[model samples]
Target: MRLIAFGESFVAGVGDPDHLGWVGRALAGRRAVTLYNLGVRGATSTKLASLWRREAEARLSDEEPCRIVFSFGVNDTWHAAGEARVTPAQSLLNARAMLTEAASLCPVLLVGPPPIPDAGRQARIEALNENFKLLCARLQVPFIDVFRPLAADGLWVCEAAAWDGAHPGAAGYQRMADLIAAHPLWRAFTLAE
Candidate 1:
């Protein structure tokens, strides 16, 4: 299988000195799969939704089945400019529509944003994540909720774990990779192949 992942810097593996995002880690040593990281920094869901088709078109191939991973949202929350500001619900709706459009061509997975350091920011992130999760269920697409699970242990506050409060470091990305690997959807693809 060939997976094309698209999103913002979080997906780009911005802070990772090794430069391998979750996509690289997920596909490590797997000859059966090739993963593409199309993550760009300073991107919003609107920008990603608007440009995904053009981006994915270039990465897709007929030789193998393709999977698209949608990971975005943190920028939206951070871009709100303040801690208490709530991201508009329409952002999630628009993101869902974008993912749905992509799913029309191939299997799509919705990967919610990671936890943030600010409690207020975390609240908005969680709400957006819940919205994304619900939409994924409605669309019958796979959903990965990384927010609540990561927030449970106050994992985002660790210094070496995730710098800049939003992006995760190598260890944090590894944890996320583990989560995706264990998911039923990931297992189905990895094992059944």
Candidate 2:
């Protein structure tokens, strides 16, 4: 299996001491799966949409089964001088475009943005998460609501707070991986014959 995880720093595993991030931890015991982590720091959904096809194409082949996992939005909701980096409407458009393209190529999983320490930013993230859920439902794609679960998780909150207020450490990443692993869609996708 060939898998591509494309998104922002959270997907890149920024704050983790081991640097595996959630992607590495999630794919750890999956035998024979070649996974590529194309997560970039500070990337928005628009940036990802612009770059994903070209990047994914380079690593994927027609002869093999390939899958894509997308996790972003926190950066999109980021405020710089009282202005958002990417507005919710634009973010949804970018996500739709990327998911449409990716679904045409192979299976796609959408992981909603995780929580941050700031209430204001987290509010934006929560709204974005809801929008993402609606979008995924319309497209019949599998969506993972990482924000809701992680927002309430003490370990995730503590680890993220201890570091950058956005990214988390190894324990938090493990928690994320566990969540993804337990999702019914994830199980079915990985265990399919």
Candidate 3:
């Protein structure tokens, strides 16, 4: 299996103490699968989507099947301080575009962003995430709601699992990976391989 992941710093494993990103953590023991981490720190969904082709070309071959995992939403909500920032509608559009592009290549697993504490910001993030989920369903692609599970457990806000109350620590990443690995989509891929 050739898996390519694209997202922001969280997907880049910014706060992981072990220094191995989720790709490294997730594909650790697979014998025949090749995992590629295309996560870029501070990459918005729009930017990541734009860069996807360039990055994917280096790892993807014409004959090999591929799977794309997209993680975003937090940056879209958190970085909207100026007029140029993406609105909720535009955020959804960006996600849709990403899904559209990914579908053309292979199966896509859309992983929604983890929850952030600020209620005001979270409202936008939640809207974006919900839209992403709906879009995934519409596209018949797999969707992973990391926000619901992580937020429900209060792991995202816990101090021990984060450095600045946002990004996940190693334990948090482990928990996140566990959640991801257990998802039916991930299990299906793992088992199929």
Candidate 4:
């Protein structure tokens, strides 16, 4: 199996001391699979939607089994200079475009963005997560909600707070990975045929 994990820093495993962000930790021991981690530190949904297909296609072949895992939106909700980098409505559009096209190619999963410490930003992240979930359901795509659980999680909150007020450390990443790995859709998507 070939898996392409694309998105922002969380997907890249930024603050984890072990350097095996959720993707590396979650998919560990699956030797039959090769993972391409295409996480950019500050990518937004607009950038990801425009780029994932080209990047994923370069590393894939039609005859091979492959999958795409997209985890974004935290960056989209990022506000600087008195405005969000990308608005919530635009973020949903970007996600829909990516998921719709990716699913047409192969099985795919959408991992909702995790929460950060800022209350204002966290609120936007939560709303975006919910919107993404609804969009996924409408499209019949598999979506995993990481925001609410991690926001309420002590480890994830503290770790993210201490690190960069955004990304978490190893333990937090492990918990996030555990959550995803435990999801039934994730299991079915990754299981060997």
Residue pairs that clash (backbone atoms under 3 angstroms), model 4: none
Model 3 clash count equals: 0
- Sliding window of 10 residues with minimal summed lDDT for model 3: 78-87
TM per prediction: 0.89, 0.97, 0.89, 0.97
Count of residue pairs whose backbone atoms collide, per candidate = 0, 0, 0, 0
Model 1 C-alpha lDDT per residue in residues 111-166, reported as the tens digit of each score: 88888777777787888888888888888888888787777756444633346766
Query: Relative to the unseen true structure, what is the C-alpha lDDT of residue 98 in candidate 2, on a scale of 0 to 100?
Result: 91
Where does model 1 exceed 4 Å of error? Answer: 79-86, 160-162, 189-193
lDDT of 4 by residue, 27-54 (tens): 9778888999999999999999889999
Instruction: Please list the C-alpha lDDT of all candidates, in the order they appear.
Output: 0.77, 0.90, 0.77, 0.91
Writing each residue's lDDT as its tens digit, candidate 3 over 1-193 gives 7888898888788878787655567666776677777778877777886898778768877776677788987877865445425667878888888888778877778888887777776777778889988988998888888888887887665833347756767777777887887778887755545
Can you write out model 2's per-residue Cα lDDT over 33-96, one digit (the tens) per residue?
Answer: 8889999999999899889999999988888788989999999998899899999999999999
* Model 4 misplacement above 4 A: none
Question: Using lDDT as the measure, what is the rank order of every candidate, best first?
Answer: 4, 2, 1, 3
Poorest stretch of ten by lDDT in candidate 4: 184-193
Runs in model 2 lying further than 4 Å from the true structure? none
| Whole-structure CA lDDT of model 4 | 0.91
